[model samples]
Target: MRPILLSGHERALTQVKFSKEGDLIFSVSKDHTVCAWYSANGERFGTYKGHVGALWTVDVDPHTRLLATGGADNTMRLWEVQTGKLLKTWDYLTSIKRVEFSEDGKQLLGVTEKRTGQLSHIVVYDIDSNPEAEQPDEPTLRIIVDELPRVTVAGFSFLSQYIVSGHEDGSVSQWDAKTGELITNVFSHDADMQVTDLQWSADRTYFLTASKDKQAKLHDARSMEVLKTYVADTPLNSAAITPDPQSYVILGGGQAAMDVTTTSARQGKFEARFYHKVFEEEIGRVRGHFGPLNYVAVDPTGKCYCSGGEDGYVRVHHFDPPYFDFKFEVEREAASQSRM
Candidate 1:
C-alpha cells in the first residue's frame, strides 16, 4: 500500500475522521486548527480557524454539514462545513477532551476535564432543535463521573441507545444516553493500566478497546465478554476493525512518550499492525510514521484507512485490490480447515 501524506498542522495531530459519505476527511491538532481535505486526492480544501487554544477533538454530524469541535479553551463550537462559519459556541468551566455526535445526529456528547479538582463530566446536548430558537440554560444531560478515573474516550452505540466510555484506569462504563444513568462498568485491563481508545465494530455486535497495558481486546458488545486479545511489545494507542465479511483489526501505537528515548526502545514498533479478526493472527504491517501513532480510522468503503500521529501528519493509505483478494482466499482456507 502507498500512503498519501497530508501535512499542515504545526503541532501534534489529535484526531482524524472521515465524513459519513467518505468523500472528505477532517483533522484537528494541537496547533489550534481544524482542517478539511479531499480524501480522494489528499488536496487541501481549507482550514477552520476560531479556536483560541489547542484543539483536542472534533466530530462531524451525520448529515456531514455541521462540525463540532472542542479544545483547551474550555469551549465547544459548531461550524458550518461549507462556509467554515462559526454557528454556535458552548462555554464550559473546563477543557473538553472528546466530542462525538450520535448516530442520528440528534444529540452531541462531550467529555470535559477540570484541572483544578481533576474532575470530569459527560455532557449531552440536543443538537437537532431549531437553531434560531433560544438556547437552553443547561445541557440535556450532564453527569459527573468524578468517582471513576478520568475518561479518555467515548462514543455512542450503533443505535444511539447507550454511550460507552473508556477510562484512564482501564475500565469501561456504559451509560444511558437519554437519562445519564450508569448501566454497568467493567474492569477491562489491569488496575494500573489506562484504556486509551474504544471503537465499535462495523456490525455493532462487538467492540474493541486499546489499552496502555500493551494490548487490544475484542469483546462481545452485549455480554462484555472477552472474545480475543491482541498483544504488542508496546502500549497500544488506537485500534479499529474493518467492516464485516472482510473484517480485520488495525492497531497503532508504540513506546510511551518517556520511554521513546530509552536505549531499549524497539524499532518499527510504531508502525500500523494488522490482524485477522476471527483468528487473531498478525497478517501484515504498514510502516511510515516516525513517531507514535495516535489514531486509526477506516473509511466506509473499507478500501482505505487513515492514521494520525504525534509527528503532526495524517497518512491516508489506499490498498491495492490484490490485498483483499488474498484475504478472501485465506478466509476460505481457514473455513475449510475448521470444518475438517
Candidate 2:
C-alpha cells in the first residue's frame, strides 16, 4: 500500500474529493487551502486560496467541469478545476455545511446552520443564475425541520432526484433535490447521537449512515426505512458501503472488542461485514490501524480503499490481488516436497 503525504498542518481534513478522472485528489483542510495532488505518484499539483475560514465541503460538477466549495465563512465559491480560477462567490445567510451539484450540474443543493429562530433548511439554487443577478431571485424553497443540535452536517447523497441529508442528530431526511420538498425523515433507534458520515449505495436502493451512537445502519432510500443496523463496541464515526451494497466496512477507531484485555494505545480494530440480503451477518474483521480512523473511502472500482485517522497517516488496502502470498507458500511447499 502506497501512502500519499498531504499538507495542511495538524488541522482536520474536512473534505476530500477525487476528480472525474480519479487521477487528481482535492482536499479542503482546516488550514484554509484547497490542495490538489496526483493520486498515482503522490505529487503536489496546485492549491487554491480564497476562503478565510476552513472549507467545510467540496463537490465537482462533471458536466460544467467546475468545483464548488462551501466554507465556514457562510459562502460558496465556484472554481475552474484546471485553472483554479474563482468563477463566482455565492453568499448565504447561514454557515454552509454540505454542498452538492445536481446530476445535470444545472443546480446546487446545500444544508446550512439554522439562523435565529429559524429551523434547519435545505436550499436549492440555480447554477446558471446568480444570487446578485440583475434581477436576483431567492432560493427556490426552504424545508425547516426541528433544529439540529450540532452545527455539523454529515453529508448528502443524490439518489435519482432525491437528496438525502444526514444530520448530526442521527436523523436522515429525503428531500426533492430540485424543489427542496421534504420527503421522509428516517429514524432508527432514536439514539440522538451524531451521524458523522453517510453514503448511498451504487444502485441507490439503499444507503448507509455511520453514527457516534455506536452503530452503522442501512436504510431503504425509497421508503426511508431502517433495514438493518450493526452495533459496534465503541462510538462509530465513519463507515463506507461497498459498491455492491451487500456489505459494509465500518471504523470504530479504538473500539474494544468483547474479548479485548489491555487498553493499548493501538487503535487496531476494524471490521467489514456482509449484511442486508444475508440477514445482517458478520463476515470479516481486521485489526488494521494503529490509530483511530478519521475517514474511510472506497474507490470507484471497489477493488481497493483508503483510510485516514487521528494518527495523521493514510493507508491504502488492496482488496483483490492475483499474485498475493505466492512466495511464502511456494517456498514452504517446495521444502516439504523435497523432504518427502
Q: What's the CA error at residue 276 for candidate 1, in Å? A: 1.1
Flag regions of model 1 displaced more than 4 Å: 129-137, 261-268, 328-330, 333-340
Q: Model 1 Cα displacement at 277 (Å)?
A: 1.2
Error of 1 at 71 (Å): 1.2
Q: Pick the candidate with the highest lDDT.
A: 1
Tell me the tens digit of each residue's lDDT in model 1 across 22-107: 77889998999999988898998889989999998999886887789999999998888888978788998889989998877778
State the weakest 10-residue window (summed lDDT) of model 1.
128-137
C-alpha RMSD of each candidate structure in angstroms? 2.7, 7.8
Model 2 C-alpha lDDT per residue in residues 1-340, reported as the tens digit of each score: 4344554425656666655455666667566777776666656778788988877777777443577888888887877777787777778777777777765566676677766865666666666633223322466655565643543453345434677777766777777765657777666634577776676565556777777787778887777788778776666656666654224444443452332345464444543333332245454554455555556666544555555544443444555453222234445597689999
TM-score computed on alpha carbons, candidate 2: 0.76
For model 2, give the 10-residue run with minimal summed lDDT: 128-137
lDDT of 1 at 2: 77
